[model samples]
Target: MKRFLAYIHRLIFILFLVSLNGCKEKKANILPEVSVSNKQKKQVVYQVFTRLFGNTNSNNKPWGTLEENGVGKFNDFTDKALKEIKDLGVTHVWYTGVPHHNVITDYTKYGISNDDPDVVKGRAGSPYAVKDYYNVNPDLAVNIENRLQEFKALVDRTHLAGLQVIIDIVPNHVARNYQSLTNPKGVEDFGASDDKSKVYDVNNNFYYNPKETFKVPVWEPDYSPLGKENHLLEDHEFDENPAKWTGNGSQLSQPHANDWYETVKINYGISPDGKKDFEELPAGFENENYKKHAEFWNDKTVPNSWKKFKDIALYWIAFGVDGFRYDMAEMVPVEFWSYMNSNIKMKNPDAFLMAEVYNPNLYRDYIKKGKIDYLYDKVQLYDTLKHVMQGYGKTDNIPPIQEGLKDIEHHMLHFLENHDEQRIASIEFAGSAEKGKPAMVVSATISTSPTMLYFGQELGESAEEDAGFGKPSRTSIFDYIGVPHLQRWVNDKQFDGGQSTENEKALRDFYKRLLNVTINSSALAGNYQDIHLFNRKNTKNYNDKILSFVRWSADEKLIVVSNFDADTNQKFQLKIPQDIVTSWQLKTGSYLVKDELYDTFSSQFVIKNGEGTIAISLKALESVILKIQKI
Candidate 1:
């Protein structure tokens, strides 16, 4: 009995070896010469928090100061670093926290004043509250006086590495104590000429709180704006007599502690009643491209805030930066995006214009009327996928979400991780970064829109650090601290995985391979057809836990499927219906399909009666991005 068992095991092992060898020959032909109209320049975004990307500090003390934690400087993004980012198939690098914001650090030596502690969130301050539109962050500059020069050099270096640059444009708000000492020639700071007496003026830059003083939120115990210490600013009161509106559009004199009281909101011709004070979009301009949108704005008067932000954008464009990521974009009117983004596109037509609009109702208004290149698909796709990974939502819902956005599918950017969301590896979230693999495969291959990866996402950063005002789970955008998992890859600025564990290295390798394959494939930018419905109805024992789809161009065809069942290995016969087989023009015969990611799995499909089907067994959390070889 023992001899018979050993023989059976050896035979199984031999068969597995043979299957592995067979896939190598099959995948080599995956790079087929398919016809395509597009230049096939797909975008992959790498969002790097400037203050932490190169900070190799393991100190990681909660609410640590710049000196104690050691902040990453602008110069830290070396040629090696940018090259590494580009080699990951990233076309754009979003330099988060590039502009000077309110910080607890005293840059008085650089002639920059200290920000009031009561308003700043963490010791490093919130990046969304822009203090200087015209200047780079002093904390990021090795030499504060030469900060702009350093940033310009970084842009040059990035372009040299063949990657475009993107920086934030926080149009909705500015620091509470807004001042622009670095405002360019012929430029005026926001509210520079506002009549402080009035709360609502069409021309005023900010909404006022007549006769009321701004009250600061009471600080919770153990949470000090200045690391266990109190200052005069934290007196539970502020001095804004006739207080300004908060960043979240709160028009109250004293905003609640939960309110975005750290920053003040900008008034863009929207009144206290939510009525527009500026001109609306011209008739029939809703469906027009930015070229016509810009023309519509010509000779048309806009609010001072619009022109101020426009000039800021144009300054960055001339400074050699390639794009802008608008923060809290929906708070600012869609008309402003039409005005701002239209002007931006007029300057550089290819400038990537992405925004955060969580409301699904406004997705079309932002993308079409606002002339935005992309909007965050968090409310639909990312949210659905996150729930699915946690085993609450069904994969069956993904098809309808895709179908609903079929008209603007290419404008909805997909991401499994970003600064605002919970980390995939956190206990409160997915609990393991490995769970992100199937989701990521779906996100990257789902459409022609861009795919973004947060800095530590590739290496399973838990983001559990008690970093100042911001709590754990999501990586803190507020504090200056080291990202433990990603810092291993940073390895004290070596930018290599020398210190990473085998699992961390493997996860990163998966990300690298998947991103490269995504950008190189013609089918990803081509057409998408949902095979999930057909598979669910026709294939026996198929469950909602599995998702299947097909994407193809003139050059090649790909059948993509993912198993979100974290504990069970699912076995099913993935079917390609007669209609799809005929449309794909898949010839009649047995053809092989290989996994583009990890290359650990492959399968063969035979076309019978104008239908092609393959037997697939997916391990727990396994995803197969099988490229169908031409017969």
Candidate 2:
């Protein structure tokens, strides 16, 4: 009997070995592919301003031609930037402003040119002033196709290095001088007789009384001047009074006098005349003129403006690009995105899409509908940076920040500084090395969604005080522009163009550590958990100086605390379940855990009974991550 039993056991062991070998063979045959499902994955995006970060072998003149500029070929990006980003192991690269936009100067008085481009007006123009939506700007690229192709090749390289590439697109308006789309008689322009449906009289009143439509110039809501001094308000007419047009032939006649910006408003059943309340037309389309225009693009026979956009989308996707950072997405109809989304995904799914709209109220509907993938978390970012830099703790104003960091179902675009904002480097902060920055960086990266960092941010680039108020303050990323320290570091024989400033280095390290932790953490990676505010009413604790939160899943947990306060130290305690104490690993700045720890007392203990309280000491302006793992 014993002999028979031993024979059976031997047979079972042989079977197990065969199965193991078969598994290995299967693993070798299959290639790894990105997840196609909507699994909650964390992504790290590195934003680049292609104009900067030059090649070492070429002439390194400041902002010169493509050759003299040192970037080599247009598609051929400098190895310096690529190598640095590749080494960091980021997920994607968002190249901001590669398109050409009209450059307009506004020197109006009373305009707050003190802030960055997004806030104040009456200054330099934005990349939003797109001259051509389909063409790449030659100023930024060497061989147009080569530059773009090479960039795509770089994307391939990045993917081989485990990263994606996303380019920016301006959908709202084009350059005032972009004749391709703006020329009154251009093939793409909306002509009164040529594309009747594309142009429409805002209200039904136009049909009942043709005189009203003919007499009134579209009265858009203009806030540019306070009266007339603000060129942006007057020129853009983003929001004007009467909110509707009074007459077509009226003196205000859509205010065509403003030449600094081009691109006229489209009447998509909204308002062109600005006289009456605008409402949607009936099913068959009550207005024949607008219908005629929509047909231009909607028509299967003609390749209209919308078709041009679709072709552009297809072109980039084929170029191996991963996504788009749409400029002025709010102004473009959601229907346009819905159509593009369906068609583009057929070619490349998981393509990251980020819109520039900062308002959730306006964008939430489309986002929920999946018309867009993400949007800039400008509102929360601005609040957090301002509060933290001021040495203030988390206040009531920061719940949106916490909510953004915790919620995962809908992702919010995160960034400390972009081409549009004031540089965070310009702000001074008080705190311990580990406390303040770690919290902010961790929150930005490990919170609810993916985040991005502008080109010079890692090197601490500051913009001019009276910088192009609304226009991009075109600066090169060669390290020497205004930041001497960064230039010195990059010029050092050992400088690989990847090291961080003393403060930025610490922040970068913290971000890397946080990323590793996030990557390894399933709970934090997807939409499996929720964030709970620990001490909400602790206004004193909620000082604009500090931020804190707890993230948890059914079987996992983590606590993040940060003190944006630059001057004062604060102490806090985090609660832990009895079982977590035994398996917890404290993840700190760029550090990883290699070994396991054990406690023999009990598999679990009672926290309320003095068993699982972890004391936290946060220095002025510092951040920490307490990671509790479950086995």
Q: Highest lDDT: which candidate?
A: 1
- Model 1 lDDT at residue 611: 86
RMSD of 1: 10.2
Q: Write the per-residue lDDT of candidate 2 for residues 219-276, one digit (tens) a residue.
A: 3475332223333334432422222222121133243323222333333233345432
lDDT score for candidate 1 against the true structure: 0.84
Range of the 10 consecutive residues with the lowest summed lDDT in candidate 1: 24-33
What are the runs in model 1 whose C-alpha is more than 4 Å off?
Answer: 1-35, 220-223
> lDDT of each structure?
0.84, 0.45
Candidate maximizing TM-score: 1
Clash counts for the predictions, in order: 1, 52
Per-residue lDDT for 1-631 in model 1, tens only? Answer: 2123334444543343344443322211122233566577468999999999989888988888889888899888998888888988898999999998988887888889878888888888889888989998888999889999999999999999999999999998999888888888899988888887899888888989777788887666665667776765665656787799998877778786677888888989988878998889977788798889999889898988899999999999999999999986877888999999999899999899898877666789999899888998876788779888888977866776776677888899899988887899999999999999899999999887899999999999999988877789988888889899988888878888879999999999889998998888889987888788778778996798889888889877888999998899999888887877777777788988988886878899889989888999999898889987666
The RMSD of every model to the true structure, in order and in angstroms, is 10.2, 17.0
Q: In model 2, how large is the Cα lDDT of residue 67?
A: 33
Error of 2 at 322 (Å): 1.1
